[model samples]
Target: MNTGSETQMGIIPPLFCIKCGLEHRLPILIMTAITEQAIQDCMTQIRQKQEPHHSLEIQKYAQLRLMDFAPLLGEWGIDDPKNTPKAKPLPNVAQAFQAAELSAEQKSKLLNYLQQAAKQGSTTAMLYLAYAYAVGKFIAQNPTKAVECARIALKHQDYRAARLLGEMLAFAPALASDVLQNDVQIAAQNWVKTHPKLAQNAEQIPQLITQYLHNPIVAKFVAKQKLQQAKTMGSPIADQRIRGLSMIGVLSSSQPARQYQSIENWLENQLAAAHMPIESDDDMMILPEHMPLMVQEDDDVPVWHKAAIVGGFLLSGAMITLLIIRFLVK
Candidate 1:
């Protein structure tokens, strides 16, 4: 019997453990389980007729739906949910934030609630605070404080903070979907493989990533790299955003396929931008023209395969030209 909590996130029984070498079934089973869990959560929310906070609850399950998917992470149809931790139910104060505006006192109470929850072992609360601080939700924008909150989450193994931490350490920050949670982490791993001496300890990763953030010239290239990645992934919305973003990295290599972290935060920002009556604000706004569109980032294509496509088109064009010339001579 799958209780709600069991369905929330259950440990793999020792029998199905990969350590015992049930490698083949492990990924398929986990993937099926994830799909089932997301569907169940959606259906439950729908049945309850929870209109006031339906979107919030659904978004939580969507994020929760993808966690610790080591074997199936890269293969799943959506963005890689690289260790995105599960979210607890939103407390009433947090839920009240769905409104167009809140009093300063209300915001304070919300912050306190999240802080208390976090202190009581809620990693998701830590994630919310990390985002809230970074984006200046209730608190002022403070990158350092955001980093501290996320690092604590990461240290506690709530992998969801990995993306926000990567953003703070990016060549430069872009919209939520541009960079990935695992970008810096994975890069650190590759770097460690090559220069074990420089990063003998994992803690050295922040310093190494920080070095890249300070280079103006390199920042443009990295920006371009991420934009190309978004374009490759087929995000037309990402296209409009390019107007003010860095275009210097035109020559830089594209990134691997990725999934978005912090789905709820992104959705919340979009709603505020599109619906908020007041114009003056701090959060990045997507104008009417920048509305969401059908995306086909061709998630299946490997980076090398995408590169090979250029050569394939050139060869085909050359062959067609030769055939036309042969017909003219004939």
Candidate 2:
């Protein structure tokens, strides 16, 4: 419905137009807001137009609307010549990222704008800049600088920056060596301990350590602390090492199914030899089909002897009965 917001500053609001209806509200506002002289001139121009000028006239009206709302539009960072640019866009940094697809040159320009915003202490801008640097998107990879920027962002209680910083410190290979040189593991462990939430991210550290340990040049450094731990706690450390080695072997083996089956078979055999029911061996287990049978016999007839007599009688009787039946049939 047409409402007061749709009306021009001074004129009474018009009924909805049949052709364009409610869509013309802003245009109507532009029409009314223009000076009377401009309106007269516009009317004259339209009257002088021929059939070919309809599209041009519509374009002119659109341009006029833009010009009339230039200040408000510019305030939203819209750069239309008719509108003013907003200091920041709605939804702030998120909109800038969405516009990253505009063009390489445009993205660079946006980066500069975001930098200015960051300088003015926009936490969102700082965080975005850090992300751009961290990933080397539109900027060279500068993890140290990214960390610095992220730290500043975090000062403003930006959880996104805190999370990113924690992640970068936890993983990023470019920073790993320097971090380790500075005893960063202890620092990270301390951070995780103090911030219980960050501790949950500790899983990422083991992966980085594994990566480091796989590198021949860096393996010694990676193994130093683990070796110390293993030396200090013998059996528990040995068990952990065994499990770790087994997992690596399983993962690295080409024939995973065969390897798993072998492991399962070994486990089952071990359990069976130990007189323990093999409840399960990784995947399947043995289950009894029925209750175990119990054997009993009178004292006068030893159990074994009684079972043998029963078997002999049944066999002989079956043979004799078969002979008799055959004779009768003949």
Tens-place lDDT per residue, model 2, 1-330, is 001222234211222222342222221222333233443454355456522222221322322222222222222333223211222233644565544355678777878977888888765577667656554456653444565786676566543443344334322322433223223334433433454442333334334333432232232223333333333432123234334533553112122322122212222232234333445568886643222234776559778998999999999999999999999999
TM-score of each: 0.32, 0.28
Worst 10 residues of 1 by lDDT: 23-32
TM-score for predicted model 2 compared with the true structure: 0.28
Instruction: After superposing candidate 2 on the true structure, give the runs of residues whose Cα lies further than 4 Å from its correct spot.
Output: 1-92, 171-174, 177-330
Lowest lDDT sum, 10 consecutive residues, model 2, at: 250-259
lDDT of 1: 0.43
Give candidate 2's whole-model lDDT: 0.41
Angstrom error of the Cα, residue 272, model 1: value is 51
Give the residue spans of candidate 1 off by over 4 A: 1-86, 91-94, 167-171, 174-212, 216-330
lDDT (C-alpha) at residue 180 in model 2? 38
* lDDT (Cα, tens digit) per residue for candidate 1, span 210-265: 33333333434444544444444443333443443324432233432221122222
Clashing residue pairs, backbone N/CA/C < 3 A, model 2: 70-83, 70-84, 74-84, 74-85, 74-86, 75-86, 77-86
